[model samples]
Target: MTSTLASPDLRRRLEGIQLPDPLGFGTLMAPVMAIAHYRDGAWEDVRLDALDPLSLAPHTQALHYGQAIFEGMKAYRNLGTDLPGTALLFRPHEHARRFNRSATRLGMPELDEDVYVATLERLVSTLDALVPERQGQSLYLRPTMFGATAHLSVVPSTEYCFVVLATPSDAFFTAPISAWIERRFSRAGPGGTGNVKAAGNYAASFAAAAPLAKLGFQQLLWLDAVHHTHIEEFTAMNVFVRRGDTILTPPLSDTILAGITRDSLLRLAGSLGLSMVEKPVDVAELVDAIASGEDVEVFGCGTGAVVAPVELIGDETGLRLPLPPFPVATRLRRHMLDLQHGVLPAPAGWQRPVPTR
Candidate 1:
């Protein structure tokens, strides 16, 4: 994949910037980014450029009306293979698929999925030196698109911009968390943008998250929007609970975001001789199961952390249930991470190796 604007200035900029120690999630950024503009319903001017701030008008459509979408992905350094410096992207097409799905839902233009993957490839290759080689660390990729037209109108903007930024970072969560059971505020409603990775969906969650953060809960286990009885998902990941010998998770509904890591682990479950079931998990039933001395565990999966075991579940009423330290979640996380880091062989098309310039 060639970038129309991959230049020597960009390479010099990359050389001058060094990766920082103790790389936090999305805190340290790569020196460069990739972008493409869409105008008159045509995508054009795709380029690899310096990671610079945008010069937008005050009436920019995205700034006012919130028509933006994004995707999270990563490129891992080969951890165990003979190729030491190899960069591998875990399920690029899957991320592209989800990105387009988000764009479709947000009334935005979708780029060619091939171009999307190629843009990522070029970006990672350009920042090959910055791809962290440590286990549980990777070059995080965030692909974002927004309405760029300077319009005060409420209708969708005619112009759009898609940008991809890279972050050299570690896993999103380092420790197991006590998830606050959110019954008061809903993350996504029935006919809302819950399923899409639009910017607004996360913005809406901050209201619920801020108070929960103060209460010392690191994460939130969101219940369904209407009844708040059925488990939907975590704020940023998909929820999986292991009950006895069977594993249960909420089925895919319009209210839940379909996570790529969640699907990958589900696909890997059968091969590991695990019984996985997809059904609506009720909060009350799960609380009862955990409180009754039954062997139950809750965990989450997403692109950032891959898998995080939920240490405790609770609500404001002082109803807290402790979960077993992740047994199934650990196994699944290790397997998937192995596949991602090239420690183990992944299925065909599951890994895409970026060519280093």
Candidate 2:
């Protein structure tokens, strides 16, 4: 087992910190973090150190030009076992692949896949004691990379820093979420950074999400930037709709993020004997279907909220579409959670056990 480079004080900090009564999503962070630096056209040593503030120059290229990218994943403590300090990671390699894709899209250097996986394993293993044991809780991992060099020119930085931070978190959304269909401010355009997990993509969403939050909506259901009639996805999740035996989700494009949980659900839908299709979902058509009782279920999928049912979707004109009982979404969420928590046997290569040092 590889040893972590965390200082003794860092270890003490981990042992002393107590999680909050309700571990809200991304609110409390673990004591240690993994960091790797890239300089002179090469990657450097990856270290596990105490979680501390980062010191960056004021004119950091990432701050100015937006060369930052990130990924969200989770590590779950195994279920039905009294084993001390053991956990499982679901589709970590898939996340690594997506991470590299995000890096490439932003003209940034990609972390080696082996290094990415090993760093994640080392971080999870080192913090095994902090991995939440509850059903809806897990160690949420955020892997972020940013251009570090300070410059005023509009160009990629020569140096970069990649870091992985962990937080013991509950479900991102505890209840069914209400979405405000965004028509005026589009999340991403046809040939933009919509496909990548770029930091700016989320920063742009604040414009639409702030007003919706004031109106009691939980999230922004983004529409296509081109026509504003097609459903792209939510601010942080992939959207899906169910009509009877068929499961429908928007087709993958350069404008929509390819979500790992979304892919897993689509594959699991086949096992559950539900037909799955990926096509352009028109907002008007979906609204009409819901009003006519043709579409019975709507949901969103992502790493944070494995599967979250959408209870209602409202537009700017005060017209709202309410979905019926979320039978399909609920079933899929249960099955996916079962597989994640080791209650059910995981499909081949889906779950990877975290090794304890």
Candidate 3:
């Protein structure tokens, strides 16, 4: 788990920089990064270096073949606790496993769990003092892997690079989001790479999200690719709907990403005496349920925002549905936040404390 430290000048730069006020999500990056490379059929030693632009070749495989993947995670500074300046990472192992899964799906070399977790720990420990202490603020960690070899033969690259970048930021969505239902564009097909967190999946979604952004919507709700009738997921988060004492979400399929926060809330729902069900959620039926006074509450969940209540759902045809107040979502959000900040008890192995050196 050994890691090389950053240069003296880089360390001084990191210490001297001031974090700006109103820290927006993923806006302010820390001055250091963790990097590793895979070559000759093995991963090289990880290094802690200055945060700078990467020196990839103009003809790199990642640029041409689109074999890039990434993971989003957070490290929190436990507030109002006996251990001041203590940092806690949430579900590092789960993220590492997902990262390996992504790499395997893209034909890239996998990163060892020890190396993945060690890189995160080293970076968080080094920047513990810089981690925001506010309740909704945290150090957002982005671990990415991509094909690095330069070739245009439509083959997977032999060389790859893994890098972890840190950003001290606030919540991604501050208010309830309004999503535009995209009926024309498809996010992923039946046999596509939607289940994996590949970089291209997101790039393919921007064409649908851009127009919605101008229409005062925050995200695009994607429907199934084959039939275009069933609800799939939002661009970045998993979809959830609450009716009465039951919670419903689309079941995991080859075209949906299994979100970590979505899984946590489903488990918490059962503990709170709420029934959870996973099935195909038809978009038309959901609209009808809301119209028929079924008291449906819609929300989105992901690692970035944790939980976001959906206030409105609309499409280009001018059909819109306004959901009621989100009591269940608010309760679940508070409970999850409390558990993350060490105010309440978290399940065993959910939170890992960073080493203080």
How many Å off is the CA of 100 in candidate 2?
Answer: 0.4
Model 2 Cα lDDT, one tens digit per residue, 17-91: 677869998888998999988999999888998789999999999988999999999999889443433788899
Off by over 4 Å in 3: 6-8, 80-84
> What lDDT score goes with residue 227 in model 3?
96
* TM-score: model 1 vs. ground truth: 0.97
Q: Worst 10-residue stretch by lDDT in candidate 1?
A: 1-10
Per-residue lDDT of model 3, residues 1-357, tens digit only:
346656666667667666778998767789889998888998888998888899988999999889999999999887636465689888899899989988898998888897789889988888776788887788999999999998887999999988999999887886899988899999999888999899999999988887876787898889999999999999999999888887899999889998889888877776788787998889999888887878898888898888899999899889788889999888877777777777766788887888886
Looking at candidate 1, what is the lDDT of residue 283? 92
Q: List lDDT for all candidates, in order.
A: 0.88, 0.87, 0.86
| Location of the lowest summed lDDT over 10 successive residues in candidate 2 | 1-10
Error of 1 at 31 (Å): 1.4
Q: For all candidates, what are the clash counts?
A: 0, 0, 0
Which candidate's TM-score is highest? 1
- TM-scores, all candidates, are 0.97, 0.96, 0.97
lDDT of 1 by residue, 220-255 (tens): 889998899999999999999899889988998878
